[model samples]
Target: MSTEQPQSGDPTGMAGPVTDDARLFPPLQGRAVPVAQDRWERLVSAVDIPQPPEAVWAALTDPGRVAHWFGVCRGNWARADCEVMLDFEDGEFFWCRIQQNSAPTADHPGRLRYLWRWVGIGPVTSVTWTVAASEGGTSVTVVEEAVNPPSDWRSWNGMGWPGILDQLAAHLRTGTTWRWPWRRMGPYLQVPLPAPPFQAWEALTAPGAVRHWLQPCAGSLAVDDEMTVVMGDASGCALLKVTRLVDSGQEFPSYLPYLEFELRRPRWPAPLAGRIWIEPVGLHESLLQVFQSGWEGVGIPAAVVERRILTGYWTSAAARAQMLLRPPGAQAPPIGPHGWSLSGGDDG
Candidate 1:
């Protein structure tokens, strides 16, 4: 991964030793994190494939060849105004409508444009793929732009860009594919709390209790209520409505006393949903589990939902509640998304 300078007459920006801009643009170290900007954020990565742009373009737009490097692409790119679904190796899926397919010719590079979205009906976020002939190879770039960027835009695409472009490079070089690994690790938490299930429910549904750990509370949380949760680190928010509240343990299936929520945001085409189920295990103790479902929906971007933020927001909130339920001067356990600890007096 040594950096090289661009040679004279080189159209491919891939030639030079990558500069600081490479981290954001492309040809970056695989581990570099995406940097954020006001109103928008950019993630750029480039690779020098020893083939011409035409070959790269074929691999990119060809449905059969795409799954080799990217995800499983469905639909006919050759068909005008075709709709495509990119089911990623990680089980995340994207719905895309082709707007322009500027095929590559011997005299000109190829340009393909699409209206990409999390669901069949959400924001028309732009995703453009460009391929150009370079000094010794082809230069390819994947650009995604959200006009009204979601709060977790950086988390959704920024952190995962390098690996994506890397897979494309490997595909060109050795025909390799990628499988998303977080499916087994995301948005799931099991932490025993020192407080009873009722007390934990109060913190979760109380008007402003979520603000302490998750985000600033907006609106109310009555059963069948609708509210907004704002991000503390960014200006984005998720709009949600509590659709059901089951409080009868006797009649409730599996010790029922759970809550269901349907999430939405203006401009997004699909719905996101979540649930929380509580189970008591001991006197003044409870087993708290937070389940963030509805990811199977195309409306919510996999990047936005398949994270600790959506998955762990409540887990972290549960941690905060554990702190609140304990007496003053009690210490907080060093629990994590996958860590486990009993609900008891401070062991420290």
Candidate 2:
């Protein structure tokens, strides 16, 4: 196969243009191209192990030993909250959190599940690793679910997993993660927000206020006290329901919607749950920031939806903020790169 890089419109903030050559190849010959509408993708990688399941399980469960083959891991094995940092030969790094673990059983000797987040990004991806004892050796499999990753990420990750798994297998047999050549990509787009202590709490709680800002699609909000919003197309629409709301009381309002939204799309999961806060930086200016934990699932990635939602919300929020603070006769500035503009020429 050709090693020449491909070109695509910039997306993941990676340097240079992205190309189709960077994507993962089809698993089967003559298989149809996977459509984005499916909302989830699964990549499975397996390797044969010359060691026994106990030895393989030890390497898999011991964070310190696993780091020797995988990447740097920091956390207590006794606790489930360990964080792992995977440094690729390319200088790129991935941060992952351990979410699930099951002790080895007779049928399946060892299994582990983890959630990964690109160090600086907003969403979380997930991976599951399984090991089983077989005739004269152990069999290991790694399964990953990428939610809303930039298109190029899929291929990059697909290529990388095999090598990592191979290292794991080799380490189990010979005890070392072999080195490989890799390069770090470019930076990503960063969108900043203002501090909050926003207008009145009523702005978000009132029906009229909520309607003014919430984008309309083919969904509705329904629940007892908390509200649920459902919107999307034929493939699927996400359902976000507010389960709890409290400001500065330890929990944040954003968590309610974030959790509900994620639950609705179990196949494609988000990595983390975060608090929402509104702080005031200027006399009448406020910032609404949402800090979320990452999650992973098996469909159209969440990164794609996150970018679109961020762009839309920022544009709309700016417009609304201006309308609230500007004088009656003054008009708000264009909100986004593509908004309409008015010339200085006066009307006849």
Per-residue lDDT of candidate 2, residues 180-224 (tens digit): 432112212111222223343335435654544443343333332
**What would the TM-scores of all predictions be?**
0.44, 0.41
- Local lDDT at 282 for model 1: 43
The clash tally of candidate 1 reads: 17
Cα lDDT tens digits for candidate 1, 21-133:
57678644586653432355555556677888878888887887777666677666534588777755332346678888887776777788887654232234777777888
Report lDDT per candidate. Answer: 0.59, 0.48
Judging by lDDT against the true structure, name the best candidate.
1
**112 in model 2: Cα distance from truth in Å?**
0.5
RMSD of 2: 25.2
Off by over 4 Å in 1: 1-42, 89-91, 177-182, 185-348
Best by TM-score: 1
Candidate 2 stretches greater than 4 Å from native: 1-38, 77-92, 120-122, 177-348
